[model samples]
Target: MSMADLVRAGAPELPEGYFYRVRSTNIRSLKVEIREQRRFRSRLVADTWVFERPDESAEESIVKACDRAFKGWQEADAVRASYLAVTAYLGDHDPKGGR
Candidate 1:
C-alpha cells in the first residue's frame, strides 16, 4: 500500500475546522488546513519525522507519527511555530490562482 493511504488511515481527529492536507506526490509531507477562519493562533502540529518503525505496519508507523506531531504541538512552543510556518508555506501555494 502507498504511504499516502497509510497516512490517510492514520490521520488524527483534528479540532473543528482543522484538517491535514497531504501532498499528492510526497506521502511523507503534509500540512494543516484551517477552514473559513478569520484568525487562529495555536501552533500547528506538523513536522518531518521518520515515522517508520521496525516490524510495524505502515498504518502503525503513520499513526505513531501523527501521535508525535499532536503531542509536540500540544507540549512544545517550537512545534506550534513550525506548524505555522508549514501552513503559511502551503497557504502560499495556490494552484488555482493565476501565477
Candidate 2:
C-alpha cells in the first residue's frame, strides 16, 4: 500500500466528546469549564466551549457543567435524559444564570 493509503487504513474514526477544566479557588470552592469536540480541518479540537460556570463542589460542579453542556454536546442523549430527570425532580425550581 502507498503511504497515504496506509495512513488512511490506520486512521480510526474519531467520536465527538466533551473536554473539561477545573480550577481551585480559595480553599472551599472551585470552577469548572467544559468544551465539546469539533473538527478543524482533519483534526478534532475541544478547546472552545459553551458552558463556563463557577463550581463550589466537584460533584455539584460536574452536574452544573453537564447542565450547561447539554446544548454544546448535542450527541449526548444521556445528558438530555438526565436533565429531564433533574427538572422533574425539581419541579417549580428556577435557575438564574449568573453574571
Candidate 3:
C-alpha cells in the first residue's frame, strides 16, 4: 500500500493541524517531519529513516521517505499502546500488577 493510504488507515483521527511532509531524501538519507497542533502552539517532530538509494530518482526518494515516515509513526503508536497497556495493568499498585 502507499504511504498515504497506510497513514490514513492507521491514524484515522489525526490531531487538529497535524501535517506531514517529506523534508529531504538522497542516496544516503530520508527525512520527514510531522507537525501537530499548529494553531497556536505548534509542535514539529521529525523522524528520519535511512537506507541506501543509489541510482534512485527524486520521485523514488520521496516515496521512500513517505513510507519511512509512515512506518515510524506506526512504530511510535505501537510503543504508546504498549506503554498504556502496561500502565493500566499497573494502575495504582505496588510492585505487583494490581491496585
Q: Which one wins on TM-score?
A: 3
Model 1 TM: 0.42
Model 3 agreement with the true structure over 1-99: per-residue lDDT tens digits? 443553554423344566655544555555566657655775765465544467885555555665566567778889999998888765355667545
Clashing pairs in 1: 43-80
User: Considering every candidate listed, which one attains the maximal lDDT?
Assistant: 3
Order the candidates by TM-score, highest first.
3, 1, 2
Give the per-residue lDDT of model 2 (tens digit) for 3-52. Answer: 23322443222234544544465655554444445575232222222233
Query: Model 1, range 1-99, lDDT digits (tens) per residue?
Result: 433454577755556644444332366544332222236544344543544567997566556666666666556667667888888655465678857
Residue ranges of candidate 3 with Cα displaced over 4 Å: 1-16, 24-30, 49-54, 91-99
Compute each candidate's TM-score over C-alphas.
0.42, 0.25, 0.56
Worst 10 residues of 3 by lDDT: 6-15
Comparing 1 and 3 on lDDT, the stronger one: 3
**lDDT over C-alpha atoms for residue 37 of model 1:** 28
